[model samples]
Every structure is written in structure tokens, then in C-alpha cells.
Target: PVPVLLNYIYSPSTSMFVSLLSVDLPKPTLTVEPESSVFSGESVTLKCEIKGYDGWTYQWYKQDKQSRWSAVSQSEYYTVNRDTLTIRADAVIHGDQYRCSGERHDRLTSSQYSDFVTLTINALPTATLTVEPEGPVFTGGSVTLKCEIQSHSNWRYQWYKGSSRTAVSQSETNTFTIRSAADQDQYWCRGERDDRPSSSQPSNTVTLTVKGEAKAVLSIKPDKHVFRGEAVTLRCDIQWGRDTECKYSWYKEANTLYSSSTTQEFRFSPAEESHSGNYTCSGEDIGNSGYSQSSDAVTLTVTEGPVFSGESVTLKCEIQSHSNWRYQWYKGSRRTAVSQSQTNTFTIRSAADQDQDQYWCRGERDYRPTSSQPSNTVTLTVKGKISNFPLPQMSTYLMFGTPKVLYLIENNAKT
Candidate 1:
């Protein structure tokens, strides 16, 4: 006893560390996100939060209308990821109650079930997005995207890029515009509000192929003023593109004239007046760059007039630069067809009121569909045949009245 007392007295100024245990269970809080009431097809997130504690695994429960609770199973409609539960609202989930409880990892302790969070799902509306002036979407151009919902009023708009969770744009109006779109992307939208059924289902995604450019330079070979039978060529050049890897769309006024995939030039071996018009060009995507800008209009004019025939007297409707031409000869102001042949020619063999009329000729080829200018008119005048006749006889009642008697007297005198 004396030795024990001496040992206890020797233990001086010892500090002991002890941990206190808590018997009170942690209570979790359940919160419904994107509003408690939502439209069908909309996603509702239930977050279970337990404050002032760590290392807790959560279990979610849903109460049936019979007041019976059941563990939520993972499925297409319901998803559980850690402390969060996501429900895709549909017709069956109109009125549902949810609760959550936590289990600790460090010790064999659990949290009390959180208060119930009721969810009300309404019928979802159809949200659709449309693009104005639908066609090929150009880069650096304003793209107006409009969202329409099946029901509800005073709805606003929210725009998203691809499947991202964040909104790229939000507006009070139902229209979202991409001002000066610089690049291509997949865009989608939905209708939203500050009241119940906050957002509708996302609209179908629209894939926009935005090119970096919309400008081009269109040029014509030789000159904008072309002559018949002259070889003409039109070339569309994109500033940031290669000739081989790009395609071009050609327009005359508002009509599409041609589309070329291999070459940058639209060729006209022999230009015609029909080929003359205001032309524009756009270059399609080359590598990562988008279409080239539409080029400034280049006006093409074909000068048409008579091409002189080699022989003036021949009056031939001949086009020397072409082959397989069908020539037609016309006469008078009515353009009456006098003759038609491979080489149209007009020659006056006889003269008459109708025969001595103005004449002209023209050459046409059907192979490439071309018609030449008309030739100068020619006129003809005819005369009757000539015949030999005796000279004028002496007047019957004049000084030479007795021509026969005088002739006889002169004969007798000569004898």
C-alpha cells in the first residue's frame, strides 16, 4: 500500500485526451429542384443534404398513396447518384412524395429520414424550334431561333448549345437570335417561367453548319462584255480556299445556274446573250473554314449584231465560227420565210410586186442553242423583156401624109 501510494504521487501533471460520443442522430433535409411541380418529361432533382456531418451514404424513399413507403429502384424514370435523386416526370408521377435517410461510414450510425417533399407533375407541352427563312445557314449571319410551346402564356426562352446543362441565352421573348454567328453548333431551346411548371421539354436539336466566310470574288475572263462566238469563262475565287477541295454554287440573278465540285471556274466555250446576267458565287466548306461570302454581283453582257459574210453579193446567212448551222432567209417586214437551207442565200431571178421586197437572213444552230443576228435587207426591181421594132412611121395627117405616093414617085424618077 505504501509503494502504490508513492507511484501515484510520482505521476505528475499528466494530460488525458478523450473523445465524446453523440447519441443524437443526424437529420437530413430533402429539397426538390426545378420546382416541386413540373411538366411531364421534365427532370426533377431531389437533393438530400445532411449538415454538420460527413461520411454518410443516403437512401431515398417514395411514399405511395396508401401511406406505404418503398425504396426507390434505379430505372429509366428514376436515377440515384449519391445524395441526389433525379426523376423524369411522366403521366404516372403526377403526385408523389419522397423522403431520404443517411447512414454513416465511420460508425454504425444513421440519420433520421428527412421531411417529405411532394412533387406534382403536370402534362408536358410540346416545345418546338424553327428557323426563319429555312435553307442553308450561313456563317456570320444572324440566325433567328423561335421556340413555341403547346400551352401556357408569358413563357420566356432559354437556349443551349449541344447537350450542355448551362443556357447560352435567356430572354423574356420566345425568340432567341444568334447575332453574327461565328461558328457552327448544335442548338436547342425550351420555354420557361417563374411560376409552376417552370420549363418545358427541350426542343429537337438543330445542327448548324456555320462556315467562317460568306464572301467571294467572281471574275470573268476577257471582259464582262462578251462577243458572240467568243470563248468566255467565269471563275469564283474564295479567299481562304483551294480550287481542288472546294465546291461552288453559281447564281444568275436569283436563279441557280450551275454547281461545280472540281473546278472553281464555270466555263462558256462560246458565250451567248442568254448566258449574260448578274452572277454571284459562294464557295462551300474547305477544310474547317465555312462557305466563302457571296461575291459582289458581276454583270455579264453579250453584244449581239450581224457578223459580215465574206462575200457581199452572195447575201449568205453564214456563221463562220460555228458548225451545223440552220440558215433561214426572210423577206419584207413580215419576215416571210423565203427559203431554208444549210447556207441561206437570197438571189432575185425575176421581178414582181412581192418578189422585189426587202430580204434578210439569219443563222442558227440547235446543238448548243445559238442564234446569230440578222443580215442587211436587199431590194430588187424587175423589167419586161426587150423586143426589136420598126422606127416611128410618118404622121398620118401631117407633112408626111402621102408617104406611099411620094415613095412611088421617087421610084419612077429613079427608073
Candidate 2:
């Protein structure tokens, strides 16, 4: 197609039109809105002004990496109305150049192309963080650590355990637990944002010391013999060289036994044969380490004499060996009523049939083990008038469900 000009005339005889064009106007001037600056999510307006232009149509073009200009306006990201065009800045506008060209009557002679105008969109700010624990856990445990920053925000957050960065979480919050005691290793967290010229200031650290599991060390006084019905105290101790906020517990065999944070002694009303077994103590440091090792075992023993039930008999508790010792007595095994004493002898007020069962004693020392042996078996014979009724050779008979009665003669003779 031939180029069209402003001075085209109609020739009726030849059925054609001639063109005449003139170039006398200055180039269009391009001015960016907002003084050539905008934030990443903001908009920018470009205005084109051309003098001496009539019936003008405007088109906008953007610059490419090779400095070449291409028409992109009149579509998305660009709007045209009269001589003004507006655009939304995307990530592509880091160093973009734009132009607005004007043309009138399609002559193309006096048309104007705008000067190169650069577009600058500021980057967005970003924030991110990392923590320890890596995962969930019990209240008290150790943790390792890790972290990274967000895109362009120039700010950072400092890690903290409780109030100090010296004990920050190691990784994501899931990575570690801060209860028992803070981690043994060094720790820190840094906050950084891209907007600021300098790095972010660290936050104050939160030092953490979680309470650990319960444990105790136990010691019994006087491992040797003790008198019946005497008082004895069991002491349970805990150790965490630097941490004193630990909890303590005492146990007998598999049972949970007792609990305390700082109670040193377990007082007993009285010592008896019922208290002859191994006892343990444990301590827990809630400040970071969970639990502690158990204390050494201790033994308690009580010696007493044998007593007879249902008959008048003498009861005594004695050491099988010649070791000097004390003794204690118990009607049954469960109840311990008397505190351990220095005397080796214990006497029942009255020997009855209930006291005829086997009984034994043990020895104890406050600082060491006390020695004691099982007492020799003693038989308590009923010495009342009618005590010989149940003999194998006796044909005893009762009337109307009444108990049978028998008479026994003195000098070990039965009647």
C-alpha cells in the first residue's frame, strides 16, 4: 500500500486522490505520574502532550531488554483515553521504559513518538523465622536449631528462650522443648527485613529452664538392729549441681511411695518387723533435664521376741548370729507402729492365740547395714484346764453345735 499524506486531493477525472503532508510540530513529551516512583502494588500514570496536533490518536509502548520498544498499551496493564494512559506495575517493571506516541489524520509526517521514560516499582517487604523442637515433645527436653529470611522486607526477629537469645529455640517451634533446662549448646535468632539499609536488631533472649522428671536418693539410719516401737526417719535427697528447683520422690519397691520437692526426712511413728525391706529415693530437675538417677538402696530391720496367742507364752526376737542388735514386734506385717530404739528386747503385754504365727526381726544402722537373723521357732502350748480336746485319738463330741471341751491333767498328761 502506498503511504498516505495530509495533502491528498480527489481527482474526479482519474478517479484517484493525492496527498500533501507537512512536518512542523515538536515531538510528544512523556511525563510519568507520581514523579516517576511507585510502590510494587501501586499504579502509575503516563501523560503525553503534543503541541499543534488535531484529531490525534495515542498508543503506548514499553521498552524491552534489548532497548527495543514494542506496542503493549491499548490492551491489558494499559488503558488509553484521549492522550492519557494508565498502567499497573507488575514484577516486570524493575527497569522498564515506556513511550506514548501520537498521530493525527494518518499522515505520519508530523506524528510524535515519546522520549524513553523509565518505570521503577519498589520491591515488597518480607518476614520469616525458624525455631527448634522441630516437633512436639514433653515439657522438659533439649532442642537443636535453624532459620531463613523473607523476600524484601528489611526486618528481622531475634530468637529467645524465655527472655534471652542465649537459649533460643533450635529450629521450628516443633524442634525442641524448653522446660527442664535450656539446651546445653549456644543458641541465637536474627531478624532481617529488606526495606532497611541495616540488618535488624536482635530481640532479647528468654532463658528457659524446665522442670525435669522426679527422682530421689534415699538413706536409712542405723542399718542394724533396733528396738521395737522406736521412731526411725528415712531421708531422701536430690542433686542437680546448678539447678535447685527439682522435685523429689520416694518409693518402696514398685509403688510410687512418696512425693516432695525439698523434704529430707520421712518420719515413722515406730519401727517394727513390718519395715524390713529395700527402699529407694528419686529426684527430678524440672529445669531442663527431665529425670535423675535413683539413689542407692537402704535396708531397715526390727528385732523382737516371739509371743504366743490363745495361750500364756513368752515371745522374743533375737539375732540368729551373735551380733549385738535391737528388736521390734508386729501383730501383722502391714502396720508399723513403733520407732526403732537401742534395746534388743520387746515383750507383748499378753501372748494370745493371735500371736502364735511365725515372726522375725531385722537389724539396721543409720550409717551402715545392721546385722540380724531370723529367730528360732518357738511353740506356745495352751496350758488352760481344757486345752487337750482336739487330739487325734480323742472321740470328742459336742451337743447342739456347742464346742467340745476336754480336761487336761498337769505333768503333760491328757484326760
Candidate 3:
């Protein structure tokens, strides 16, 4: 009797019962540390993470080339943590697909597999360090260190000192410039790419041997003693240093002949008496502040010897050391001891043809016979001579006739 009443009592709300069931969670995300593409032998970390969740056990899977998925185990090439995996050895092979999934520890709910991530291994490029001006460098000189990576252009460079890992300089370009290089400068370089942000192996270490400041030697082309109006060329040579390009400065005693010159050869078209002083030169490396030591003083002797005939000529004996000197003149290798002047000049007034001879002078001081080096010989040439013309024939016949006429006139006047 109750069954008929119960069958008619079913409500629509009874069919809407709340169902309690577990919802499928979102898949975990897998990412590689640094980048997916990395150089072989470089350490890399693979991380599996589930956002906004805790106490999740992560399982990592690597898919082979045959499209078969298998669980990864801890081995020499891999170190497996709870949610992270590390590749320890040289990762040479490529095309390994990886995925990760997470499971809740309490509810035993599993998440779907993450999107596949592929790893690409590349061989590290070889880095080489090269120096500019490969010879021995000098102090305070500019030097460039170039890092070369063959077949690679998009690379950043890092320079380091000897055996030191700390980077002394970093540049987007490959070259590292040093404005003022010092002694004991050693360097090495490494190259890195921005895409992977991993550094290649260190390049060969390059040791920079900085030499000391070089001493410059000044030399004169031809003899230092040059005739007047002759061209003279002075050269500044730095024989020992790497800095061959230098600015030259020429000095005549205390006066500066040229303030700055890029050429090592200082030329004088027509050397004059003013250029007869003690000349010296110093060299400075281009773009450097310090100058080399002054060269040895060179004595430039300029003499003017041959003179025109019948002209008043003076023979001067000059010395670079002291002005106080007595002059003794010589003619044709004969020293004229009788005539001595306290001054350095010996003058010949009204020079005759006999005076045309080789003349030289020597210096003496304090009436001492000891003389300095003999001056260069100078020949004097006398030019013109007097001319005598024969006197006109005397008019003897006309003179006799005039005398006889005068006598006859005197006799007639007396008669």
C-alpha cells in the first residue's frame, strides 16, 4: 500500500545531487636555465615547476628520436632533484625532447604532461687573443688586444689578467684598447654570445712585455761639418723600442729649431752660419707626453773660404766650447807664428795674387803652444792684375827740327 504512495512522492530536486570528484589540474611548465641551446661541456639546469601549488612530486620524461617516452634516471650525465635536473657531463648529442608532469601528494591527483622542450648542443668556438704591434711594446704606448672567434661575428669579449678569472674589461666589440700600457701586462680573453649567454673556453694567454723608455740617437747625414749653403739632414733614430712612429724635435744649443715634426729627418736646405751651433734632437712617441732623452750634441762647422781677388777677406776660427781663443793663421801648411791675434779672426787687406793659397787656422789660449783641432782648409783666389802699356814712340825728328829753328832765330835776332 506504501509503494504506490512513495513512487508518486519523488521530487525534481532529488535528481540534482552534488557530485564530488577530482578536477584535472593544469600541466606543469618546464624551462631550461640559461637557454635551450648551449655549448657542449657547459652545465645546464632543467627546472619543472607548478605555479600556486606545493608538495608536488615532479616526474621528468625524455622522448627519443623514435617518439618513445621514458622516465629519466639519475646517471653520470644527469643529476635528478625533486623538481630540477642537471646535466653534468659534456652534452654532445642533440634532438632530445623533454617533458615534465606533477602529482599532488595528498589527493593523488596527476597533471597532464607539459609542452615538449628540445635541447640543442653546439660546439664551443675557439677564442684567440692577438696583440697589435706584435713586437715588444713600450711604456705609455697604446696597445690593442683583439679577440678573434673564427666563423663567428656576434660575440662579446671579456679580457682578463694572467691566470685570473675576474674580467678586467668587457666589450661588445672584440678589441680591447689600452691607452697607457705598462710593464708586465699580461692578458687573455674569452668570447660569449648573447643568445646562450655562455662563455667559451679561455683563449691562449698573451703576455705583453713592455719595454722601458728608449733612448734616441741623433745622426747627421754626410759629415757633421758641412760647407755653407749645403744641405744638411739630421735624423732621430730609436733603435730599441716598439714605438717607431715618433715626433721629432730639433734643438740648436738652447734654442728650438723645430718645435714639433712627425718626420724623423730634419732637413736644412742651405745651412748657414746661424746653424753652426751644437745641435741635438729628442724623440717623442706619437700621442705620448714623455720625451726621450736628448741626443748627444753634434758640432756643425760651417766655413766660407774662397774669396774674390783684391777683396778684404777675414779667416775666422770657430770653436763650440769657449769663445776666448787666440788665432794663428796658416798658409800652404806653414803656420804663421809671428802674427797672432787674441781674437778668432785674421784679416788680409788688399789681397794679392801671391795670397792665393790654402789657408787654415788654429786656436790657442794663455800663450800656450798647444792648439785645438785645426780648422778646415780654405783656398783663397786672387782675381785681377795691373796692366802696363808700352809708351808711345818719342818724336825725335820733330824735336831736333824745333831745336835747330830756335837756334837760327836767336842768331838772326842778335844780328
Candidate 4:
């Protein structure tokens, strides 16, 4: 027994070195994003990678069950071309369980699984909104306002006046009737999704203003100082009435002188003696009695008188009392160019010794006349002709036949 123990103890102390190589496990990375919680129908991509392993083979595995695993059937689906492995996740396949395993030489390394990702799919709802007017909108006219949402499953409407929010519609129906015109108020509409509102852009505003009735008034400019044989006009202006089918009428002494069934100026050209009277005007109202009051009467005066200058003028008018009388002019009791009208200026064209005869202006008319009165007398004298002077004593001497003394007197007379 001593010999057997000695032999065992005599064996040399041999050392054995052992090293453990660390091959990193393949880690599954998410290259693609999952569907967002807010939006739906999205796409996702996943990739797997492993470090510390060169020239290593890879395999992809999906973990649907908590503890079980399944190989991805399609090699392209797993996409393990290199150390990095990628895969896609659609809307239907949202939940997790993805991993990658690596192998170096003949030894298999452990695997890394990806974190859980979720997916959701949603369908956008059909939505639209519109407005309707009950009737044609005119300026100052009443109208009905209607808001219509055609088919909005989960949407709301907002009504606005200018930049201010007026009303909101939770349900489908949104309408408002306005008895007044759009000029009274401005309106527009907007839409929103769910309870929270989106960016709102209002519709274009509609404006309305309607016209009512027409009105008119009369404006007249009358003459302050009117003269005979002078023309005048009565102007009719439609200040508030309709321009179409407007009429006018002018009257003198309560008698209509002119009536126009349209808008016109009634003009009197070269006014006469009878026209020297009261005048007024009135406006007709739609086949009814006149509405506006008559204008103040304008008076016209007829003046007749003679203006002249003469000597010894006994203006003989063959008649009686003179009242409202007109006058005429005469030369040598013969009528002149003057009428029964007033002359502003009168002058004799030729002044001769014959003009020294009696000349005067007399007043006359159809009713009566005035007696001619003598003006200052004028004496006519012949110049440079003493022989033309008549002498009674000389005429008796000349009548007797010529004696020697008569011949001497004749020679003296000739001298």
C-alpha cells in the first residue's frame, strides 16, 4: 500500500488552461415604425443585429405565443442576408415577438427578441357642409339662412359673423332664418372633427341690399322782375320721384298753358301782353290729385309810353281821359315808327326850320286818349334874306306903278 501511494504522489503536477469565448447574441432591432395611435393603416419595418460575431450565420424567429417560437416561413420575409436581419409588419400583424439568432463556425449563440409594437387601422369618415338661402337675397330684403351638412359621421359645424363666432352645430342640422337683408349681417361657416376643433376657414360672406319705392319733389326758379315780350321757363326736377314716366304742367291765371306727360321744361318764348298775369305750377301724382303745393304767382307788367324831345309840341290825340294809356309818336300829325310802347330814347334824325312847327307826344289806347297840350313855342327865322321880309307900307308903295321916285325906291329896295 505504501508503494502505490508513493507512485501516485511521484506524478508531476500538470496544469491545464481553459478560456471561454464570448459570442454576442443577435439583438432584434426595429428599423420600421409601428402604426401611430392617432392615425391608422400604417407600415412598419424591423431589423436584427449581432456584435462580436463575424462570418456568423443568422435565422429569424417570431414569437406570437408567450413562450413558444416559430420560424418565419418566407426567407425574404425574414431577410437574413447578413448579420442584420430586417422584417416588415403590416396593419393586420401588429403585435410583437420577433428575434434573431447567430452561429459562428459550428456553435449556436443565444437570441435577442424585439420589444412589443402595436398597430391600428382606421377609415376616414365622409364629411361636407354647405349653406342655402330660402329666397333670392336683395339689398334691404329679408331672407332665410340655412346651413347643411351633407354626410358627416363625426363632424360639427360652426357659424360666424365676420370674425366673431356666433353659433355651433353638434348634430347635422344647422340653419338660421333672417328677416332682414344680408346688409344687416354678414355670415360664414366652418367644420370641426370630434370634440376638439381643427383649423377653421370660414366661407365667403354673402351681401344683400334691396331697393324700395321712388320719391320726388319740385324745385322752381321764378323771375323777380318780369317784362313784357320776355321769355320765361318753369323747370320741373324729379328730386325724389321715378325718372321714368315723369310729367309736368304749367298754369297762368289759373289756366293751364302747357302740360307735358314727361319730364320737361315748359318754356314761353317772346311773351305777349296777355301773358302779363299770375302764374303757378303743380305736379301730378300717379293719375291722382296733385301732391305738391303750387308755386307763388309771378306778375308781368305791360308798359307803353313815348319818350321824345321837341318845341311848340301840341301832341294832338283825337280823344278823352287817359288811364293805363299807351302812347305813340307823330311828325306833322303823321304817325311815325313808334307804337303804344315806352321808348327809352328819342331824337329827330333831321333838324330843319320846318321842325319848328308844333310837335308833341300824346297818349292813346283802345279805351281813351288825352288832349294835346302846347309845349314851348319856337320861331323860325330865314337868314341872309332881308328882301323876303314882308313890310305893309313897302307893299303899298311897290303896288303903284313906278314913277321917277318909284324907280328910285325900287333901286333902294333892291339895295
TM-scores for all candidates: the values are 0.34, 0.36, 0.52, 0.24
Every model's Cα RMSD, please? 23.3, 17.0, 17.9, 27.3
lDDT of 3 by residue, 230-312 (tens): 78898888764544567888899868999678888988867654567788888876644445777888888754423444456
Number of the candidate with higher TM-score, 1 or 3: 3
Give the Cα lDDT of each candidate: 0.66, 0.52, 0.69, 0.41
**Regions of model 2 farther than 4 Å from truth:** 1-24, 33-45, 50-55, 86-91, 106-111, 132-415
The ten-residue window of minimal lDDT in model 2 covers 401-410
In terms of lDDT, the poorest run of 10 residues in model 3 is: 406-415
Worst 10 residues of 4 by lDDT: 402-411
lDDT of 1 by residue, 280-373 (tens): 9887654333456789999997643221111112344445455777777776887666777775444443333445445556667786547666
- Alpha carbon deviation, residue 322, candidate 2 (Å): 29
- 1-415 in candidate 2: lDDT tens per residue? 2334667799999999966865445578888777744656556788888875577777778878897888875667677778887885553366788887777776755455778788776654332334343333223454333334444343444455434535333333323333444344334455544443234334223233334433456777654455345677788775443534556777777467788546667767567545656777776544444566677777676544322233233333433334444555443353463434455444444455554454334444343335433333223233334454533221111111111111111112233
State how far residue 273 of model 3 sits from its true place (Å).
Answer: 4.1
Error of 3 at 203 (Å): 3.1
Q: Give the Cα error of residue 306 in candidate 2, in Å.
A: 23
